[model samples]
Structure formats: structure tokens, C-alpha cells
Target: MRQKMLLAFAAGAMLASCGESENAEGPEVADLLFSGGTVYTVDGDATVAEAIAVRGDKILYVGSAEGAKAYVGPNTLTEDISGKIVFPGFTDSHAHLPDGGDTILGLGLGGLTSAEQIVHAVKAYADAHPELPAIMGSGWELNLFPDANPNKALLDEIVPDRPVMLVAADGHNGWVNTRALDLAGVTSETADPVNGRIERDAEGNPTGTLRESAQGLVSHIFPKPAVEDVVRNLEAGLAYQAGNGITATIDAAIMHDHNEAAYLEVSSRQDLPQRVRLSLLAAEEMVTSMVTPDNVEAVVEKLVERRAQFRAQAKDRLDADAVKIFVDGVPENHTAAMLEPYVNAPLGPDHRGEINLSEEALNAYAIALENAGFQIHIHAIGDRAVRVSLNALEGAIETNGERPRRHHLSHLEIVQPEDIQRFAPLGVTANLQALWHFNDAYISELTEPFLQEKLHRWIYPAKSFVNAGARVVWGSDWPVSTSDPFDSMEVAVLRKNPDDANDQSWIPEERLSVDDMIKALTINGAYLMGQEDIRGSLEVGKQADFILVDADPYKVLPEDISDIRVLRTYIGGRQVFSAAE
Candidate 1:
């Protein structure tokens, strides 16, 4: 009779009980229950809960610790997370996961300070890997070199026999040896591609440096990684992100067809540690040649077919609902399009940088993508690039009407005040790389002179965007920057590099609050990925994706936030990463 009563109560409450008879029915007993921690829901109210119960992959309960006890039963695993802070699993809105993984597995050149160091490292790597067909690596910063430009002469002196190409930290430029240039048939007569530049000497000879689209000349000839290698690298990258409390990420640029196939294979095997959304590269020609009205339709058709193919292949875990377009290059290289002339242009004062796509082409492409039900993710770093992207989005809206999907504008380094106000009204997301908010070597030494008086004011405007009611999401742009969300959060909040004692806030007014930063990393990111309703916060019906940290970021000093490490990360109620393990 007691068992019957208990079963009735459970059924009435819609709670599942473990070890119940086959005849018994209820909602199955929670497989796991986490209690005694400060649970940050990050919901609309930013509510705090004391306990949460999970059944299968969904949260079954979230309320008082005592109330959670009712759902506990045999076969249930309960953890007492006393003194720990629990948060919704972080989501990286922008990242190159596969490429970052490849960097880790290959020659990691992320932090070398000089050209000499790069040469030594490259030589050591080359000597160790004589079997490689072509040498390729990334992560060289322009500020470390004299004149902020790396020439072929340095590379030729070290590895003149073989082709070698090293990418800049930002991935916007490529530095190669003379052999690489020669192998790609890039010569002084090679007319500058539509949106790319081949740096040349005074005598019109190729200098072995390529910017933007021109990098494709050498990159296309480079041997592609095997499918197994790509899968291995992607797994490594996903593990790194999970260890840092990231539960989801978007591969900002899915470049090759092989990359898409690898991603589909991984998702099929359920080996992916975190949720992944892929943004297929739509403007490949713009990167190598140019986007013209003549080829715009062909490009759109290709993107549409690719999207359908990927979606049909991996219908469950894969999301190919977005397309990536590189509107302009980086500011440090003076390639990012701008409204006003650059203060220190290599060509002349009249040079305001170059736009990768014409206005008509951009408009047509954006409209076509939107009409096909794809979210547009544009890379716009400069003020003029941002404005042009906005104009394209506006045209798309005028053509197709407003859609449910919120488009994104990433790497917002130089948004004008007028453009800042346009974000909310246009329903566009400000996908910001908050890690670059501080005065880093790139900003101080390489880019400052070019901006002149607009230095601080033109940087990331996080606070201003939020105040204007724009939806803001944060990303690391990993491989270009650190993938740790806490590191980015600290920089976002303090507006200064946490590692540099001498550094001051670059733009004090742009600093975000702890609450705002948390939301940006969690809920806002989920919204950007179109998964807000499923896993953004700790709700009764949402997916059980959350993490346990060593300390509460809200209670710690702003500067100490980055020191608060993630002890465990959970995705779909499964412990995928643990610091103890």
C-alpha cells in the first residue's frame, strides 16, 4: 500500500522513479542530481537556484535543495557541489575549431616574439618532418617584425630549398619563402587579384608576402589533411574547449568540402564533445579573386546546394544554417575597408583600404542567402566594412522582409557611432571578439599609428552596444586568440590585459559588467546559434548543459575572474570533461 501511494504521488508529480516495476508509470527517476551549489540560471530574470535534477539529457527539476530530494531514488547519482558555482555551459559564438586543433597538433607558433624565433622553430619543425610534402604553419604576428611586415628574404635564408608558408596570427596575411611564391607561379606580372594584394619590391618583383585573397595562390596548392587527421584535430580542439567550460561552438569558417565531410562524420559517431554549428564559406572567390554581379548567382546556387547536402548528410547534430562572408581583411595590414583615408597608408594618404565585394554583389548575395533561410555571418573589421555589411543586410531585409534568424557581424573593431546605433534596429547581433579589447601588441605597436586620434574610441564598443539594446555575443576567434572564455571575460570586464601590469584600459567606457559578460558568453551565444530555447539556461525542460567552477566569478575581483578555473563540464547531463580526470 505504501509503495502504491508513493507510485501515485510520483505519477501525479510527473517524476520518474528508478527501479520501479514495469507496470509503474511516472516521468523515469532523475539519472543525476546536483545540489548545494550556487546555480546561475542566466534566464531572463537571471534567477538563482539551489539544486537541479536531470533525467536522460533534459533537466527534470530546478528549485530548492529540499524539493530536489523528492526526485532522488535508487540508480540515481547525486553530487553535493558545496561551495562551487554552477553556470550554464559557455558557448563560443565564433571560432575555427578544426584549424586551431591543427595548430596544436602541428608546429604551434602562437607566442614567439621575433622573426628569428619563428625561423629557428620552422627549421626545427622542417628537419623533424622531412616526409611532409609542403611546410605549412600559422601564428606569426606582424608587430614582432621590423616595419611590421615579414619578407621572403628571411624565409629564403632558412628554408630556401622547399616551399614554406606561415600565416599571421590574425589569419589575414601569409608570409612565405621565395620557393613558395615561385611554386605558385606568383610573379611581378601576376596582376593583383580582385580583393587581394601581392606585396612587391620597388622593382615590381614579388616580395613573397601575400595579403587576403592572394594567400589562396599558395594555400590551394598545399596538400590537404586526411579525413582521419582532420577528425583527430577536431576532437582535440573540442576537448580543449570543453575543458575550458565551453559546451558549444561554431566553426566560423568551414572552408573545404573535406572539412564538411569530416564534421558530418564526427557528428554521426557522436564523438563530438560539444555541440557544433558550421558556417560554410560562401565567398571563396572573393578571397582569391573578386565578387562580381556576373558570378553572384552562380556563387549563391553553389552555397545553397552545399548547405542542402550537409544538412541531409547529418540531420541530427549538424547545423548548416549559416554562411560566412569575408567582407574585408584586418586593420593592422591596412586592408580593412574604411570610410576615411588611412593616416599611414603604404600606397598614399588617399588609400582607405579595399572592399572585397562590390555593393551590388554583396546585396544580391545577402538577399539570396536570407531567402534560402540561412543566417549571414559577415567578417567586418573596419568602420567602412561594417557600414557596407550593414548596408547589405539592410538591402536583404528590404528584399526578403525580416526573417526569424538573427544575422551576425563579427570582429567589430572599428564601428562608428552611427553604425553602433544601427545594430539593434536592424536586429543584427554584434558578434564581438572581446579578447581583443585590451591594448595588446597588435593594437599598440602595429595599428595605433594608422588610427591616429580614433585609436581608443574606435575599438570594441561593448557597453555602448548593450546600452542601445543590441544583442551582444562573445567569441575568441581561437587560433587567432586564446579560446578561454574566462580570459575573454576578464578583458571584457576590466578593459585591460590581465597579464600586463603596466597596461591600462584602452576604452574605459566600453567595459561590460560581470552579469552582462556572463550573459554574453551563455544565453546570448545560444541565441546566436538558434539553440536558446533548448540549452541556454537551467530551465525545467532545457538540456542539462552546465559547468562547475572553482569559484564564483561574481564574488571574485574583476582581475581574478580568469583565475577561476572550470572543475567540470557537462553536456546533455553527461560529464564530458573533469579537471580531476
Candidate 2:
């Protein structure tokens, strides 16, 4: 009985024309009624609803044709979507929107094969902005270079007169010309900072490349862009997110600078199409602005007060529940702390991943913050860093009893199987970006020699994590890779390198199904952010946040999934972005 009825209703919901027959007398009135499509409501039991009726911003009804009709009115418009698919709006769990936007507008040297090509691209930009003091570019690939490392020598050839600095693709390193180095006062005599390294050539000469905090040395000397420029970059990023059906994103890093202030203004004005979860970053010394040693309790109180102000102003547009902490940088180029020595670096055998803070310091800070009811989004890319974070998290919880707040390991790019189980116990979410599997070919090669037994393991272990009952959400890590959720979904399922077929993909068994992939991009992401109760899936009372695609995902082959186009995107029942209209 009830089971049969549910199955029949689900069948009707899967078909586009079934709803029409239910109301054959006339069209049922609805502000918007989408019928006849594969609608994936990634809610409990993974319900497949037939028709979704929207009245204003929230879902009026979501069920079979019979259930949807009760909410219809005389002026409602019904859409026949027989050849389409509807899923909750995607969420990018971690990305640098402004950086990505600026990169898109700047010189594109993401995959240049050699430093010479990068110099040429910079020269082309210089030709137009001849009066500009120095050239600033980003997105350089070390793997693409013949020497597998870039230095200032390459930049000197093309622009010896002008100071030039190019940030590495990972955002952890920089390559500067000799002129830029001299202007910044970084020389062979400059000692490497605690959390950074200055790469050098033979005879103790400073090479053009600076890793981690060392890059900050050269960047501080450059003139900063205007607030209008930051706003423009943010607008570009917002448009990009809307085009890709991304409804929200967690910015990986937010510094206490004028650019951030301008971003908040833009966000409060709703100029940003996508919702932002801003996480402020600060050093231990800088924490005094919001906290003090004598009145640490008062500082926590102020942090909350400030967050409330931002939330009230931005309304549903901003979430200020977390603060970011950079645990360590990337493992490539020997900046990312590793438990073992680099497989192919000049460094000795006893090298380990860098720790920006002592274990005690990290544990104490996290505990204090958690007790104050603020979430901590830790940036940990390497396995050693993950271990340190896990240890710190454990210590923090021990000091302060477990609370309902969420903790995240922002780029869990390399997790051991054993760590997967710990995530659920530790209340940590794996914020993974699957698109890296498509764009980055060096990850596997660089990791193989280090983890010999677990060589070439897939970074986003979707199946294993799901099996372990661990929550896994997808992210774009944009600016580092393309910010297309469809592209990311396509890569996660197919496990095929679209960029280079010759590059073999690993752990095919770890790939997720289309159904699971949709959930990770939608409800799972919402769940991680504590927004699942109001948004995420399509259901009665849930916000009408979804996108309509041209082709039905169920009918298309996995490889052809990326061919599906987003025709329209709706947020809170409003047509925020429409491609056709």
C-alpha cells in the first residue's frame, strides 16, 4: 500500500508529462511549477519528487503531481521540463573568488610550458601599461618547466628594466626579476623567515623564487590597487559563480586589509550574486585587535559582536561563523611540511612539513576560539599537516568539551584511509575540490615516491568516505582551477583527465555516482555550512535555490555530463540568472 503509492508517485515525478494529466481540467495555478524532469532532492532517503511548486522564495510543495496541485493558483505559470534536470544550487566549499576573478582579467599563464612563455605574456601586458611601476602576474606552473623550477633569470631577459613579480599557481611561491628583488631589499643576506623559504642558487645567491611567507617580502613593496579595482574583481567572480550555478562559496583566506573592507561593502549591497562565508585571518600577535591576554574572554565577546553586525547587515548573504588559520603551505617545492623528506628536492633526508605555530600554541588557540563558539577552518594540504591539525583538534576538544559547531580541514587533498574514520569522530568535514584531478597532473607523480605503498591514491576518496559515514563536500578552489561545478562533477565521476588523456587517473573505484556527486555539490555542501535546514534540497519550506539544465543527467552518459548546460538559475524563487531569457 503505502510503499506502492510512494513508488507510483516517484515514477510520476521522474516523468515530465505526468503532472499535466493530474490536472487535465486546466493548468494548476502556481507562481512557478516545474514538472516533468529528473528532480534530485538530496534529502533524507534521497527522495525523487515529481513536481516542485514555488510560491515566492521558498518551496510551496514538493511531491507527486497530486500533491503539487493543492498549491496552484489561477495566475501560476507551469513549466514543462520533460527534457531537463533540476538539482539544488551547487556550493563551492573553498575558493578564492577575488583572486580568481583578477587572474581571469589578468595575463593567463596557468599552464605555460616554460618561463620564456610567461615572460612573453608579461611583456605583452607591459606594452599596454608601460607607465606602470612594475608588472604583477600570477599562475605559473613549475611542473611545466624543463627544470621543474622557475627563477628570476627568466624574467630579466624580457623586462630587465622593469621590476616584475609572478606568483606561483599554488599561491605559495613567487618568482621575481633581479630588479624587483633589489627594489624589495631581498638579497642573499636576508635570512629565511620561520614559515617561509627563499630559494637560492649556487654561491648563496638569492634566486628569483620565494616560497610561502618569503613572497610577502617582495609583495609589500608593490603599490596596492584601489578599492574600486577590488570591487570590480569581486563582481567578475560573482558573475563567474552565477554562470556556473554556484550559489555560495567559502573564501579560503581573508586578510584584514582595505580590500576586505571593500569586499564586505560589495557583499552587503548584494552586488555579489553568490553568498559568501567570510573567515578572517590573523597572526597570533594580531589577535590582540579582537582579543587580549588579560581579557581573552572579552575579545571572544567582541568577535561575536562584530560577526552579528556583519550578519545583520548582509542578512542571508553572509555567514560569519568561522575564522581561518593557515597551518602550513603546499607540499610542492618543499614549502608544505611533510612527515618525510621530499622525493626529489635538494634538501636532506630528515625534512618534515613546516609548522607555523607550535603544537601547544595551535591547540591553545583552537581551544580558546572553540570555547568562544566560533568555528575554525584550518588550511592543511599535506598529510603531516593534517596529522598536526587532527592532534590539535583533539587537544582543543579535550580542553573544551565538544559543541555543536563545525570544524573543517579546507583542502584535505591527501588523506590516509585511517584518517577518513577520524573525521566523523572529530567533527571535521573534508572540503575537497575534485577539479584538481582534471587540471593537476603533478600531484600523483610528486606523491608516489613519498607514500610508496599508497602511491597514486585518489585525493578525493568519495566512495570510501561515504562508506565510512563521513560527510564529504566538493569545492572548486577556484583561481587555482576552473570554477565550473559541472566540470568538477564530470571529472569526479569519469576519473578521466580531459586535459591530457595520456595522464593516467588513479583509484577509479573511489569515483562517485552521479547521484552521490549531485548531493556532494548541493545538500552535502549546505549541510557542512549548517544551511541544510533552510536550503540545500528541494522540499516544502526549503528555499527555492536550484538550476535548470538543458539535458537530463540520468539520460546522458557520464563523459557527456559536462555537455549539459545551465539554462536558468533561481535563488529564493527569483530568477537571479537566466541564460536564455
Candidate 3:
């Protein structure tokens, strides 16, 4: 009887410490408490907890169910999860939300395998909306066309009278009908730009296919969407991100010339659901014009004033981290600058892979930007362009040393192992899109013949970089790819085309664990943007940004990882997404 009394006294003391009262009247109090679920907190130690507590946009406690219950107050909202899984809200390091929104708003031809199907979809959309002036569409694959490349003649055959401009899946090219060409004033005499190709036939006639810079010819003439339409599209994009449990996204390339004002206008309102980071780009000539020798001090003062005003509103959301410079186009259309001649089709005696900037000019630009303390994200695809970019980066580091600010390599599709090492030392973050591994079969076909075993190892080389001590971050390259972090994570972990059965995944050894992958999508990205203390993972006193899934990725088979559904997304203690009404 004495031993039993002692045990009862200890138990009572424990209950008291947990703040439990046997005679309590109301429902268990907690600002937000969830139990009967697995919480995979991607903390530094990767600890697992049974429950979490939130209070006014911050996580107050994360421990046992009993511990979380202690924070319950009179008006607490308690949720019994009954064995679900939760994780930190996903963050997309790179995206094009507005562009993705625009594409989703327009005709979606992503899955169509043939021209006939595209025609049917286009005709159906036109019939449904008779008031549309021109039927514009995007996401057509070059392989789907008869010539292995698209042409306006085919679109002309489908809808001869109506003008159409359909962008290729890669976004590096487009196909416009005769009417669109006529409207854009693109005639037989129009010459291709220095870095872009205007596809031509044996007779030297325009073939309606615009490659690289030439696509601008038709794009400049396309009608702009109304403000209302823009708002709808932006909302659609945010909804898509929220639905996928993404809390933040970085717009990889922001064409401020066309849409910065609209972004400011839309963002001024309260409709933005996801946090946005926009990278600004200015033409080389325009950048030079801003810093002329005659009025350098005045220009610097003006830029500082403008930056201050932008900072006052943005605080952390908007950043002018870098000025984008296009060194060369993609390797798909034979425009990317390469060290060696392509095996399939060698260039003539005078021809080489297209180099947009001469070495002298590029070096000068790099020095100037480095001196001005601007991080540069150069578009490099071919080996030669990559070399040029590396040289420029080396110049920057030699002049300004390395710092926390990360220089980016956009579409770094073909990095040599040595170049990755160079990046680590220079503090250049490898902002890679793993989904590109599943897509871009055309690239595989071209690279396989020459690169052999090295063909598909470039996209998201997680294991290699981690071993090398490089800070690698995951990005969706949205609009170019889906913004869904789950989908992106699935692709990274599995390294296979979820849709293709016959296609093989490259370098199975390159796969990373779920924990590492989540860190890349969360903490690493947060650290890159310098928001580690405020966002990233769930911890006491941190912002309450998290997502609850129907299943636990840690316990599930890797193949089923992609299918795990998102039940709800919470940001700042508010329910941003919930399955239940």
C-alpha cells in the first residue's frame, strides 16, 4: 500500500507539471494543437515529435502531446490528426509564377502528342470564346511536329485565317502562322538577330519557326492581357502554389521591362498568398547608359535612392540581387556556345557556337558588375559558354573576393565536374531544377552520342555536390517546370520520369535521402535568401509555416512518395489551405 501511494504521488506531480486539471470544463486549450500524428520536423537534428503548438503566427512549442496541451488556453483550436504527417512548408527557390499563371490562363497543350490534337484543342477554345481576337497558345513540343521542329505553315493549314503564335515547350522557340508573321511585320527580308535563329528552308525562305532571339519578332507584336486578366492569372498561380503547400517562391527571371509595374500594382493589394523574390534584369546597353562617364555620381545617387524606396516597401520580399546577362541560348537549337563542334552536324569553316558577347566586352562587363557589388546570373548552356561564365566569375572573385551573396548559373545544364568545384569555392549556389532530368529528352538524344555515360548526370547532382561541400539548393524553374515542391522532390529522390516507363533514370547513385532533399527545398533555400532565422523549418519562436500531408514520406516507399497528398498548409498560424470545408 505504501509503494502504490508513492507511485500515485509521482504520477500526480507529472500531471500537474503538464498543466492538466481533472476537473477542467472546456475543450483542451491550445492556440493550435495537433496530436495522433507524426511530425517530421526538419530540424538540425531531424527530430520526430508527436504534437506541435502554435500561438499567433509562431510555433510556441513542439514536443509530446501532453507538453503541447500545456499551452492550451480558453479559445485554443485543437485538432486531433489521427495519425497523419506534417512537415515544414515547402519553398521553391526559383519560379516564374506570373508566366506560369499566364500559361495556365491560356490554352494548355502540354500533353498533346500530335498537331491534330493541338488543332482540336485550339478550335474548341476559339469556339467557346468567340470574342478572342487571336488564339494564342504555348507548350508545344518540337518532337510532336512532322519536321521534328514546328513551322507556321502547319498552323496556317489548321486555322488559315486566324493568327496564332504557339510557344515551344522549351520557351526558346516559337511557331507563328502566316497571319501572325504578317501582323509582326516579319517578312522574307527580316534577318535573324546575332544570337537567335530564324529557321529557313533550302530556298532561303522564312519557315515560320523562330528560334532564340528571333521569337522576339512575333512576341513584340502580341497583344497584352488586360489588368483584370493579369490579376486572375496571378491569383491562379498563387492558388496553384498554395494548393501544393509552397509558402515561398523565387522568380528566376523577372522581365521588369514588361511586368514590374504590374507586379508592384498586384502586390500592393492583399491578394498575394505566397512570398515572392524577384530578380531584375537590364539590357547591357541600358546598364551602361545608367552609369555614363559624364554623370556617374548622379546615376549612383539615383540608383541608391531608388533602391532605398524599393527596400522600404519590400523589406525582404523584393531584391535586386543580380542583373541577368544572356551569354548564349540553349544547346537544343545549335545556338549555345560549345568548346567542340557538335558531332551530328558540324559547323562550317567560319561558324562556331553563338557567342553573344566578345571576350573583351564580357570581361569588362563582369569587372564593372563585380565592382558595383551586383551578383550576376548568366544564362549558359554549352561548354564554351560555361567556360566564359566561369572566367567572368573568376574575375569577380579575384577583384571582390567571395562573400555570402550567391552568384547563379541559370540553366546550368552541362556543368563539368571541375566547374562545380569552382562554384563551391566562389560561393555560387547551384540553383538546379531536378525535373529537367525527366523532361528534355531531346537533349539526352543529342548528348548521348558524344557525352556517353556523362549524358544525364548534370541535372541535380545532389550526392556529388553534397560530398564536395557545395551549397546546393533545389528550384522548380516553374512555368519551365511545375512549381510543386512535392513533385520536384519526388523526381529528385526517384530520379525517374514519373510518366515514362521505357525511359531510364541516370546515375541512380546520385539520389539523396528525403531528409536532405527537404532541407534543400527548405532551410538551404531560406539560408540562400537570408531568411533562415524567420522561416525554413518548424521550431519554437519561428514563423508557423508548415504543411500536413496525408502520409509520412519517412515511412512510405520511395516510389509512392510522389503520390502523397497535401491535406493542409498553414502560414503564420493561419489556415492557408485545408481539405475540409
Winner by TM-score: 1
TM-scores for every candidate against the unseen true structure:
0.93, 0.88, 0.86
Worst 10 residues of 2 by lDDT: 1-10
lDDT, candidate 3, residue 385?
79
Over 4 Å off in model 3, which ranges?
1-30, 146-148, 269-271, 284-309, 315-322, 346-352, 359-375, 446-460, 501-503
> What does candidate 1's lDDT look like per residue over 390-486, in tens digits?
9999888888875686899999988899899999999999998988888887777767778757645867788999998999998889988888888
Evaluate all candidate structures by whole-model CA lDDT and list the values in order: 0.81, 0.71, 0.67
Q: What overall lDDT, based on C-alpha atoms, would model 2 receive against the true structure? A: 0.71
Query: What's the lDDT for residue 510 in model 3?
Result: 71
Clashing pairs counted in every model? 3, 8, 2
For every candidate in turn, the CA RMSD to the true structure comes to 7.6, 5.7, 8.1
Worst 10 residues of 1 by lDDT: 1-10
- 2 against 3, candidate with superior TM-score: 2
Cα error, candidate 3, residue 552 (Å): 2.1
Positional deviation of 439 in candidate 1, in angstroms?
1.2
Q: What lDDT tens digits, residue by residue, belong to model 3 across residues 179-275?
A: 8888888877888765576777777667888877677778767687766776677778777887888887776665534455556555554335676
lDDT of 2 by residue, 1-581 (tens): 00110101221233222222224675445699987766777666566767788877777766676666665777888877874778888888888777777887876577677656877888889888888888888888867653445777778877888888887777777788999889888888999876777888887778888877777778877778787887787778877887888887887666656546666677566435677787766643111122224554554565666567677667577767777778777756665656655555566666656767666667766777798677888888767778888888888888777578678887766667787788888878777777765435466445454443453473556677777777778878787777777777767876667555454545787776666667778988888778999888877778888888887555566556666788888888877688873
Model 3 clash pairs are 29-72, 30-72
